[model samples]
Target: MKKILVVDDEFDLLTTWRLVLQLEGYTVVTAANGVQALSLARADPPDLIVTDWMMPKMDGVALCRALAADDRLMRIPVVLSSAAERTPPIEHPLVEFHRKPLSIDSFVEIVARLIGPA
Candidate 1:
């Protein structure tokens, strides 16, 4: 099973993503903020990460940069989901950016493509 880490400050969004990804048969791990997300990733890296840009502590852009700088975690694919007007520069080749308020099908398709075969 593919492992996914979802990072967002909102509790409801975190729970919703966990449940949605779990239902899709992916092993889901969640973090309420970028700091916790980075900690979890260092402890046990997920195959893919879905993060919100406006998170407290580190925020998604900083988190992405940090992960990209780390050789061990740089290879992991990252998908940024946000409603922000500005998009962060994808420092790593494996990173992808997407807008928020995503439809269920679009989310599933992106997740499936990144993680592969659910």
Candidate 2:
């Protein structure tokens, strides 16, 4: 099964995403903030990452940079989401930006494009 790390501070969205992705046959892992996500990724990297840009501890942009600096994690594609204006662009080649309120089907499609089906 493909592993996915979803990082967001909102608890409800986190739970909903986990259930939906799991149903789609992907092994979903979650983090409340980028700090937690970074630690988790270092310990066990995911096939892809879906992160909210305005997280509390560490934001998605920081996570993307940290990942890019790590040779092992740099190539992982990141889907960065935001409800407000788009954040500053990340320099990493694999980063993609998307506006928030993503429909489940759209979200799944985005994931599949990056890492294929679970």
Candidate 3:
């Protein structure tokens, strides 16, 4: 099973994503902030990461940068979501951005595309 690390500040969204992804047959792990996600990744890297842009500690961009800096975790694909209308200015090769008001169908498609159907 493909493992996905999901990071979000909001408890409801975090639980929603985790449950949704798990039901889709992906092994989903969650973190409330980027710092926790980064630490978890270092200990046990996941196939992909779904993260919210505006987190309390170490935002998504910082998490991406930290991942980029680390050889072991740098190759993991990242799907970054934000409430901002425009895409953020992140240029990492393994990173992609998604605007908020994201639909479940689109979100599933994105994940499947990145790491294949679970």
Candidate 4:
């Protein structure tokens, strides 16, 4: 099973994502903020990451940049989720962007594409 790390500050969204991804047969891990996300990633890196843009203690852009900078974690694909009009500069080769209020179909498609069928 593919492992996925979901980082979002909103508790509801975090639970929703965890349930959705679990139902999709993915091994889902969640973090309520970027700091926790980074720590989790360092301890046990996932195959893919799905994160919200505006988070406390370390926004998604910073988290993405940090992950991208680290050679050990740079290869993990990232899907940045944001509701802002202006997207953050997470222009790493392995990162992709997803606008907020994402439909289930689109979300599933992107996740599948990134993690390869789960």
Q: Which candidate should be chosen as best, given lDDT against the real structure?
A: 2
Candidate 2 TM-score versus the reference: 0.97
Q: What is the lDDT of candidate 4?
A: 0.90
Superposed by TM-score, candidate 2 places the C-alpha of residue 35 at a distance from the truth, in angstroms, of 0.6
- Model 3's TM-score against the true structure: 0.95
Model 2 sits at a Cα RMSD from the real structure of 0.8
RMSD of 4: 1.0
Question: What TM-score would each prediction reach against the true structure?
Answer: 0.95, 0.97, 0.95, 0.95
Worst 10 residues of 4 by lDDT: 84-93
> Across residues 1-118, which tens digit of lDDT does each residue of candidate 3 receive?
9999999999998998898899899999999999999999999999999999999979998999889889999899999999987665675679999998688889899999999989
Better of 3 and 4 by lDDT: 3
Which one is best on TM-score? 2
- Residue by residue across 3-115, what tens digits does model 2's lDDT show? 99999999999999899999999999999999999999999999999999988989999999999999999999999999977578686789999898999999999999999
Which sections of candidate 2 miss by over 4 Å?
none
Model 3: residues with Cα > 4 Å off, grouped in runs = none
- Between prediction 1 and prediction 2, the one with superior TM-score is 2
Models ranked on lDDT: 2, 3, 4, 1
Tens-place lDDT digits, model 4, residues 1-118: 8899999999999999899999999999999888999899999999999999999999999998889888888999999989987784675679888788898888989998877876
- Of the candidates numbered 2 and 4, which has the greater TM-score value? 2
Worst 10 residues of 1 by lDDT: 84-93
Q: In candidate 4, list every pair of residues with a backbone clash.
A: none
